[model samples]
Target chain A: MKTNFRTAVLTVLIGAGTVCSAVAQDATTILQKMDEVMYSQKDMTGKNKIILIDKAGKQEIREATIQQKGTDKRMFRFTAPASQAGIAFLSLPGDVMYMYLPAFGRERRIASSAKNQNFAGTDFSYEDMESVPFSQKYTPKLIKTETDAFVLELTPKVRSDFSKVTVSIHKEHFYPILMEYYDRGGNKVKEAKYTFKKIGNYWNPAEIEMTDLKKGHTTKMQMTDVKYDTGLSDDAFTVRALVQ
Target chain B: MKAKITVLLFSIFVAISGKISAQEENNIKLSGELLTDQRLLLRDNNDWAWNENRLTLKLDKQISSESKFYSEIWLRNIGLPNAVHSSSLYNKGIIDPYNLEIREAYLQINGFLNKKIDLTLGRQQIVWGTADKLNPTDNLNPYDLEDILDFGRKRGSDAINLQYYFNYDFSVQGVFIPFFQPANMPVGIFADLLNPSIAMPQGMVLNNFSDTLMMPKYNLGESSTVGLRFKGFAKGVDFSLSYVWGYDGLPYSSKNMLTPVNMNGETNIQSELSFMRNHIIGVDLATSIGGAGVWAEAAAFIPDQDMVMTTDLSALYPGSPEPVTQDSVLLKKNKPYIKFVIGGDYFFADGSYLNLQYLHGFVHERGSEGLNDYFFLRYEKTFFNEKLKITPIGGGFIVTDWGDINENYAIAYLPEISYKATPNAEITLSAAIFDGKGDHLFASLKDYNMLMLKMKYSF
Candidate 1:
């Protein structure tokens, strides 16, 4: 009778251990699922450009390389018009840093106050160029589920300059599909939409559109050609490259 | 001193009132440049070396949704306002002049008359033009050196304007300028006859070469003008036409001989006699086909019914006993009084574009003198990862038989390079070879080589 009781206790302990291990595996799977979609392509080295048109039909074009590291950070190198070479812009989660020109011999850092100003004397503002980490500032609620992507309605956790920002993330890839920004007055200031395609095991967007609501202007960016793993180094981001 | 104090007190009161009432309406915008030119101005040679370092600040505050106030403050030569000219001067030499002068100050009110009209009464810039250097068709506001020297862009005028926009496609504007500063002409010895301080050799020769002789000196005359402009998309084409009339303080003069002399003989003093009203008519057209865009413009100027002529040669030799008079000689001389331009730009695949332009000046028969013909050609290309872009330009003048540069040609070779060092910064290096007067107008260190560098931040 004693031997039979010990066997039952061992069986129960084994069953509990199996259940805990299964739960841990499930959590790991979920995290990987999110990360795989977010960072499917690491070090996506390529050239891309966008042209924006205003109501007056004036056009401005911007070109850069899309780079990545780990799961959150990405750097862009501006290589067009000798005037804007070696312009380095880095984004890491909620934080962003940008450095540009100060004549030929000097490199001046951009002040935070200048972010709201116009970009290159154009209608687009500096804040309109890149995205702020949505996970840090908002309580994102999954509003709807679609076959290919998910819609998220983000409400700011604190009183801030921007009232609300809506985002769409690809379901299978976890890549960003679209983002809509709302001004302080609850007016839709601008909307950016991304369209992605699969190329050799990598999911990247071939084109993106950013439209301004108040000004009736739109900027379209297209990645015509791309080269991955080009072995670009950190030294390429220096001011010396501006002239080289 | 007492008036200045009173004015200061009033300004303070206004400031306090604005601050107390409109705390949330303050909207300030800052825009300017930190620039240095390689052309340092020279004194006498046709070739000159000129350099400029400047910064400008603009501030605006809305008194209400309907009313707003704005001002533009400038700092020039960075620290040498006094060393440079005062039109928008910065500092003199060792000390920073610390100028708080107003480049533009104005009050604007909108949503008037049931929200159908907009009224702006103050100093404001009104711009309309298509071509770069040749903007003769853009007559909304006259262009001047003060506006050009300051930024190469035209500026605002002290006036009150009203515009009624029936919709996005149609609008009519009436501008009443109580006063306007005309473009400054070079102060020549002949041009300064009225100023007695610069005395020439005693008993300098004087000649009356124009028919009209009695006219006012200052060109800043009071005038009121009303214009009807129609801008709409008709058959997918954009077009506009304008008509204006006002008192022209600087009247055109016909060369007349006070004591008749032959055309070949030596001439003396020239006087500005008589003045007249001016009537202006202008039109503009623009259309796009496929991926290319084209535009054209025409303008005509009719001087006041009674006009006079002014001569510069008179001031040079103040002691000449008898001046020569030739009307046909004066009217058809250095430059044409009327001008026009037609231009177009075409966009190509892979971020490439081509621009073509043509300009012509109409013959002015002020007793019959006309300036030579002027034209330019420009071409630009981008390649090398788009990291390198080059613009090679060449153009010159072809004056008429009697025109100054008659058949005399001058050309310019410009190569502009743009290097994108990173995603956020850019550096532009521009070099060009320009041959011309290289004087006050577009003077460089030489009538030859010019180099410019620009660093931009696109954040």
Candidate 2:
């Protein structure tokens, strides 16, 4: 009777380990698929707008011509709201960034120390707009499987503003549906939600909303006229390009 | 010839506009700004206040895929004729203080030399420095000192700038300015002291008010003004090395000596202000570390000759005018000096930013302590979703070897609060306070303590 009991216990333990391994693999696969789908293009250009809503429901809008090259470079030139016109921002790899303000008539290099700070008075931080691939920056573990979404708890593999992030991914298209950012104390501080739509052979987030729980403010970035694989020049994503 | 030149330029503009209108992708943008300032002098309850209104109109035209044109004109000082001298229209039939000043009109072309070179021609502002306000490498344009109450404003330069890009991260640029523009200095009244426009005895109440200031014009060439810049980004750091063979923008002269003349029933002082060739070599670096932005800039100036100014103070202190109580003295010369600044800035979570800097100016020539050190601090806070920004900026200067009779230190503080009422409108309120004694920087401008309000509307 003792020998039979030991055999049963071992079989159950082995089966549980195998199940845990398979679950982890599934979480990674989901994250990889999401990254692959959004990062499939070499370059893209889009007309973007950021709408900032304050606590009192006052709204301010900024419009820009946003372009991206390769997977690591991004540039934006503000065109609306005369006060912010002719302002350009360029982001390169290694957290290198630059800003050209027409009022100053020169390009200023931006350091990486303020990555977690607000970007252009928006609720989104610079890190929130950073293009570091999710699969490259975080390690995911399957927390639960929903009826239509996969919940993955991510621990940053690199230095990040958030201690932990819980993300929800669409089951069919593998696009990120939601992300809740937690502080070091494990308190939810911010949440980002995305609504994806298929556009010209690719899935894109047509609407993105970022909410700051502490500040009680929300910022929405809506994408329009987005074209993928447009063959943007590498020079266009550089600091020198800000002059134009 | 002038009319012909104007017609030729007009033809070029019309041709470009025609081409752009024909293209489907061309865009023409029109925008402008009007800034109105109302200031009150704390010391002067009656006269000598800061009041000015400015209007700027800008045009941006995309001529083609590789060409663009931009232009701006400034209409300054709307309410009074005191500031009408800057307007050429005043010389014409327009008799109001509503003066017109062309700020920038530049055409930029790309895709030259197989897409490696670019050019910008006409009047434009070019800023070159890594530091904030305490920049040592920004010597491109002459300053607008006509309004002493307002500082840090500069006029654009007419030039042709050529740039050659290398690998998109580095570039070599050369600027050729065909002419020279000197800093503007206006005559002002001194209630209880000597007027700065003329080198007369302090506190001397002369029966006749007469002074002659002769200003010389300098032509541009290898001996006058030229700029060369090389900038590159490497290893997460951006750096630039530049040189300018230029003249002092603030019309200084080797013949600044004052001569109290008594000739042909005239008793006044004559001072000559001229420009000479000078060379400046500058280098700057900027990088990020941990979460703070660090930058430094340094420039070394070499002048063709030394400047000397004579001060005769004994005649004004209850002394005889002929056998002066003390002999006239010539101030020392600062032949060549170096100016440098290092600064860093950081942002806090509450959307507050802070910057601190240290600047060392080698001003004193023959002293153990030749350096004048200044510490600059600036703090800004964005409130109510960035609609309101409050900034407090100040500095402390420590002159190591101060003047024999002047104060050894000085301090200045300015706090400004600006509110963005709308996307195209802003209001700013600020105050300037200065304190020192006897030849210190703040002491010199102690009478300029003021409260200012400015409204800016943009479209």
Query: Which candidate tops DockQ?
Result: 2
The C-alpha lDDT values of all candidates are: 0.51, 0.75
Report residue B340 deviation for candidate 2 (angstroms). Answer: 1.0
Write model 2 residue lDDT over A64-83, tens digit each, in one string: 89898777899988888999
* Model 2: DockQ vs. true structure: 0.75
By lDDT, the best candidate is 2
lDDT of 2 by residue, B154-206 (tens): 78899888888888779898988877777665323322222334433453333
| Candidate 2 A-chain TM-score | 0.95
lDDT of 2 at A3: 95
Q: lDDT value for candidate 1?
A: 0.51
Residue B123 accuracy (lDDT) in model 1: 76
- Least lDDT summed over 10 consecutive residues: which range in candidate 1 chain B? B186-195
